[model samples]
Target: MDFYLTALLQGLCLSGIALGIYISMKIFNIPDITTDGSYTLGGAVTGMLLSNHLPIGIVLPVVIIAGGLAGVFTGLIHTKLKINPLLSGILVMTGLYSINLSIMGRSNIPLLNYTTLFDSFHFIADLNWNSLIVLLFIGTLLILLIGYILKSDYGITMRATGNSEKMVSALGVNIDRIKIVGLGFANALTAVSGFLMTQFQGFTDINMGIGIVIVGLGSVIIADTFINWMNISSIWISLILVCLGAILFQLVLAFTLSIGIDPTLLKLITALFVLSIVSLPRLNLTRN
Candidate 1:
């Protein structure tokens, strides 16, 4: 029971990353790999600040800004230098490895002895359950905020920019600027996941974000599956489905572990699962 509970909290923490990936890949149609680096950057920033006795209020915003900066850098490289978006993301992600290292000044940091945002509340009987509650509240707030943004005028334009860049440009909109803002917003959400996960696990590591993008991609794929199957047209409904996808993904992993799957093989299993999701639609199309 405790194991499943932990997985639930973990999924909620990572839902932010799923939503961020949805923005970059689904909404903006940009394969921004910067999420790998920016996620670690968020953890690095949070760990460093908390170690120095910083307040959670300040720490959260700063970590978000750091992540946003990484996205903006990738956006600038792609837009200004005319680099491919994939390569631009790669460059920024590569640089962020060093940047995250410098920020932490070490490979890992443990926060078992430090106070975290989750410590502020003591409403639940079980400590782990209490943290889960807090994470639930935070996750709900994040989903609502993102949903509101997607329904806004600027967000519509961002979606338009992704759907038809030439048409958006023809409308006299600065498509490049929209891309930059969209990427920045996506990365900021991803960083929030990093921050929450660091606090939840009571430790932060430089390599903790390695291959995290795959997990997020899996979540987005699951979300897309539901959206297509249900014919979901509302932006809010789509975002909610994305959150559900994140939870379901984690639950599936938990079930795998419960069934005695080797931890070493978990990555392989995850990759295979994502590959199946990616290929199934195309397979259906071929059959048709």
Candidate 2:
């Protein structure tokens, strides 16, 4: 029970990134590999601040801006230089490695002795349950914000820009600017995940974000799967499912580990699991 609950909390910590992926890949039609770099940037910033005894409130905005700038550069490069979306993301992600290290002044920062975002809550007697409550509160707030944005006129324009860039541009929307904001917002959310996870896990590691995008992709894929299967069209419900999908992804990993799989094979398991999720939807089409 504790094992699964831990997974649930892990999933909750990752909900931000999952939603970020949904925005970038599902809405913007861009596979933003900037996720890998921005994620660590978030953690790096959090670690650097907390190590200096900075408050969480102060740290969060800095993390968001740092992450946003990383994304802005990717979008700027992609649009102004006509670089391939993937290539632009790769360039930014590559650059963030050095930037993150420079910010932290080391490859890792341990925060076990420092105050963290999770320390403020005492609503529940059980440790894990308290964390769950905090995560739920934060997750709900994020979902509401993202959902509100997606339902707005600007969001519709953003969606249109992705669905048909030329058509949106013909209608007078600045698609380039839209892409930049979309990616910036998405990566900011990704950075928030890093912020949550570093506090949740009690340390920051330089390579922590490596391939972390796959986790978000898996969650988004699950949400997309259910959205299609249920014929759902509501953005609010879709956002909720994205958070649920993050939890489910972690639960699946927890189950896999509980079954006595070699711990060293976890990354391989993650890749195979995500590949299967990506492939299963297409497999459903074969039956038609």
Candidate 3:
């Protein structure tokens, strides 16, 4: 039960990345693999600040800006250089490895002895429950903010840009700017996940974000599946479902571990699990 509870907590923390991926993939129709690097960048920033005894309030904005800039870098490469979006993300992600390392000044930064945003949250007596409470509180605020933005006039244009770039461009909108801003928004949210996870887990490793994009991809896929099944059109509902999908994905892995799956095979399992989610929708289409 405790193991499952931990998984739930982690899933909640990870929902930020899912939300980020939701924006980049579902909204922009771009597979911004920069998520891998931006995530660790967030962790690196948080770890460096926290370990230096800096306050979370100061650390939070810096993390967001760092992540957003990384995304913007990817956007610039893709839009200006006319490179493939996927390749652009790959290049930015590769470059961010060194940037993240330089920021942290080391391969790993431990924060167990330092105070954290999570540690400051203590609504209940039970430590786990408190963490859960704070996570939900923050998550709710994030969802509301993101939902409002997506429904805004500018956000509508952003979505339209994704649906049909030519249509958006025909409206005299700067399609390139929209794409860049959208990617910036996406990766900033990804950094928020790194912020939460580093504090919760008590350490940050340079390699912590390797293959992490799949987690967001898997969660967004689950959310996409649910939206299609339920015919959900509301942005608010979709964001909530994305968060739930993130939790569900983690729960599935937790169950796998509970059933005695080798931890060494976890990455393989993650890949297979995401593959199943991706394939299931197509399989349903074929069956129909």
Better candidate by lDDT, 1 or 3: 3
Local accuracy by lDDT, each model: 0.92, 0.94, 0.94
* lDDT at 236, model 2: 97
Tens-digit lDDT track for model 2 on 1-288?
A: 999999999999999999999999999999999999999999999999999999998999999999899889999999999999999999999999999999999999999999998886689788789999999999999999999999899999888888999899999888899999999999999999999999999999899999999999999999999999999999999999999999999999999999999999999999999999889989989987
> How many steric clashes does model 2 contain?
0
Give the clashing residue pairs of candidate 3, or none. Answer: none
Error of 2 at 149 (Å): 0.7
Candidate 2 — which residues are off by over 4 angstroms? none
Candidate 1 global lDDT: 0.92
User: Which residue window of length 10 is worst by lDDT in model 3?
Assistant: 118-127
TM-scores for all candidates? 0.98, 0.98, 0.99
- Which residue pairs in candidate 1 collide? none
